[model samples]
Target: MRLEPDVILANRLADAAGEVIRPYFRQLTSVEAKPDRSPVTAADTAAEEVMRRILKQDRPADGVIGEELGFERLGAGRIWVLDPIDGTRAFIAGRPIFGTLIALVVDGQPVLGVIDQPISGERWIGQIGSWPSTTLNGRRVQVRPCRALAEAHLATTSPMLFSRSGHAAFARIARASRDTILGGDCHNYAMLASGQLDLVMEEGLKVHDWAALVPVVAGAGGVMTDWRGQPLRLGAMGAVLAAGDARVHAEALERI
Candidate 1:
């Protein structure tokens, strides 16, 4: 497989972030609450800083949308989205599931993405077009099929993030699926991409939260959509679903 400039740079971006985030996990680091009451930490800011500095030097003309720093030069044809520590709560608690997310969106679509777990040194790389599908480390990976909801292994971060209107839809899926686990954050999506998870549904996501996930899941032969079963974009309404099998994704969409 040929490596594009975005893919090569995205790998380095994740590495730079990991270097900054590793020293803070499980250690006494400053944790602060955002205006919205979400928890953030020095690690989150520091990691994003590292990534942003690299992007400025390497992809200077490209735009950036970062979780900690907000948007910059965002109208450019190619934009980089960064979520340095996707599961900040998990990171704070020393859960290895937390990941650094980086995505390159060009012409409004994500063409390249990386999900990196700094502690474990595990990276999932995904890209658009017709070549390599997806990979964990250096090996190929793909999502598994589950035709029926009764056979699905569903996962989510939490029901607490579900919107009031989305609750019944979520309940229906939870009742139908064979198993469900809460609080995997982006790890659940990575697992779904690797065929270990059959389905993942979540609400209340920002673009930075789910942008990288689109290619990761799709390149692995899965489907990711909004609650209405449409493709994801930068300004989506936050309700999202990812499924390994095409049939199951359609079935879940109908139920939602």
Candidate 2:
């Protein structure tokens, strides 16, 4: 299928943000803690600024909510959600797992999403009412079929976000799954959408963190929900569990 206009725009924004991030990918002089103690680097601010500018230029009427700059309500019934570098800690440490995230939210629901890994030169895009697909240098890819949670591979953006109950739930699910991996931020969700990975469970997310991922996973014929099995709506509180297929997601949620 020809890419939808919004999806194309999302990819363009991802590429533009990647251009801003690539030069500093491995050349960070130092990293410091934000007031909240989360890691931050020059790359994050610069890339976000680049994306913000592109959105303002191309969709001047739409609102924008970015991790670094917070929110701008433009009253246009559309919003661009951004996480310029989803794993800044990993990026600053010289890991190639970081990626840029963008989502077009209409009336508080994400309709278009993109995740780009500049170091890997891969982009994943998903839109409402369309099949999710990945592009490695612009070639299409689909998610793999893993129908059972016991057969699925699992990943989490962070292990520490789990509570005692949450951790136990994760452990139970992990024990049932084929394998578990860690620490890819938005990349893990992209992998699940592309069928390279089966499931990713994460807690303590800001809307910016998961908004771009929801459409990407869902468009790939997968399912994404809060732990309660509710559809993932923007601004919802609690953990997120995304799976490559509904059956696998149901089974995994049962174990959790």
Which candidate ranks first by TM-score, i.e. highest? 1
Q: Global lDDT for candidate 1?
A: 0.89
Please provide, for model 1 over 1-256, each residue's C-alpha lDDT reduced to its tens digit, 9 standing for 90 to 100.
3547778889999989998988887994578999989889998998999899999998889999999999999789889999999998999888999999999888788877789999998999887664347899978999987879889999999898888878889999899889898998999999999999999999999999999999899889888899898888777878999999988888888888
Q: After superposition, how far is residue 113 of candidate 2 from its true place, in Å?
A: 0.6
TM-score of 1: 0.97
lDDT of 2 by residue, 55-152 (tens): 88888888998998888984658888999999888898889888888998887788778888898887777776676454545666667888788899
Per-prediction TM-score to the true structure, in the order listed:
0.97, 0.93
Q: Give the total clashing residue pairs for model 2.
A: 3
Clashing pairs in 2: 132-219, 143-195, 144-195
lDDT of 2 at 50: 84
lDDT (0 to 1) per candidate: 0.89, 0.83
Clashes of 1: 0
Please report how far candidate 1 places residue 49 from its true position, in Å.
Answer: 0.6
State the lDDT at 188 in candidate 1. Answer: 95
